[model samples]
Target: MKSAHQRFAGRYRPPSPKRSPLITPEGAAALKKELENLWRNQRPVITQAVSEAAALGDRSENAEYIYGKKMLREIDSRILYLQRRLDLIKVVDGLPADPNKVYFGAWVTLIDDDDNERHYRIVGADELNPSAGCISIDSPLALALIGKQLDDRVELNDLDRGYDIIAINYVNATST
Candidate 1:
């Protein structure tokens, strides 16, 4: 088991997600809803499951109890994470005046010379879910794409792969 000091002490690095003071009101509401649901619905459900399993006695041999406790702890950890994130976040409640530029919350679509297309949204590192189409603003791809406008191609040298990708298409957030 990790010491309590190990878990809570030391210099804390804030999450690397782009702190945008601008976000769609919808996004903010969604985060709030998730936080609420985790605390209310999921928290109690997992606790109840653990209680029922513990009632079986002999916790040392109780698989259900051990797993249930682990899961409940995981859920609680996630809740704490979300709470901290929500507190640091500056939710952009509306679109910025400069929609033509790439910034936090802007959905960008990039096309390679081969016409292969991929879309990404630059957001905070905490929100970096590739499956959800969100990429961290601190990432290499987003770094390459930032400030680029329509028809302004970006050439990225993937050093390890010894290949360069030529960006042929760019779509700013407003257009997408």
Candidate 2:
């Protein structure tokens, strides 16, 4: 007889590819700070509120109590996730040996086909903030940019546009 998964092949979906476990030092630090804040600062306040709400009695009808409990569960879940991720991720602190090529944690400047300039920092998946121009290393754009040199053209297979690497720096220019 076929296995259960084989019988339900149509309904079963394969797991997504695992994300890169590498994280920039700044990203690691930010995760740490967030975990600390949620655990020590936010959790306590919410706990206190929950306690106060509970003392009011009739928790089944208490909105404050319900909301506080939900917030506490969310905070705990995040704290657990952060702890696990922090333990699993490897923090990349220093610059790559070849500064001339694109690599993780590098702030790259690209000129697109339209002559529009775009800057993106290749970082870990956990720290990707598109609005801030921080792209995940596992992203298609970052994957294509990896190992590329200055002035090299990158033709994205999925996108209609191509980009030229105008600049690549390990340090964040805006930070200075």
Scored by lDDT, the top model is 2
lDDT, candidate 1, residue 15? 80
Each candidate: what lDDT?
Answer: 0.69, 0.94
The 10-residue segment with the lowest total lDDT in model 2:
167-176
- Model 1 misplaced regions, further than 4 Å: 1-27, 159-176
| Backbone clash tally (model 2) | 0
Off by over 4 Å in 2: 1-16
lDDT of 2 by residue, 29-101 (tens): 9999999999889999999999999999999999999999999999999999999999999998888899999
Candidate number with greatest TM-score: 2
Q: Which ten residues in a row have the lowest lDDT in candidate 1?
A: 161-170
How would you encode candidate 1's per-residue C-alpha lDDT over 35-91 as one tens digit per residue? 899899998998999999999999999999999999998988988977876777666
- Model 1, position 170: C-alpha lDDT score: 30
Q: How accurate is candidate 1 locally (lDDT)?
A: 0.69
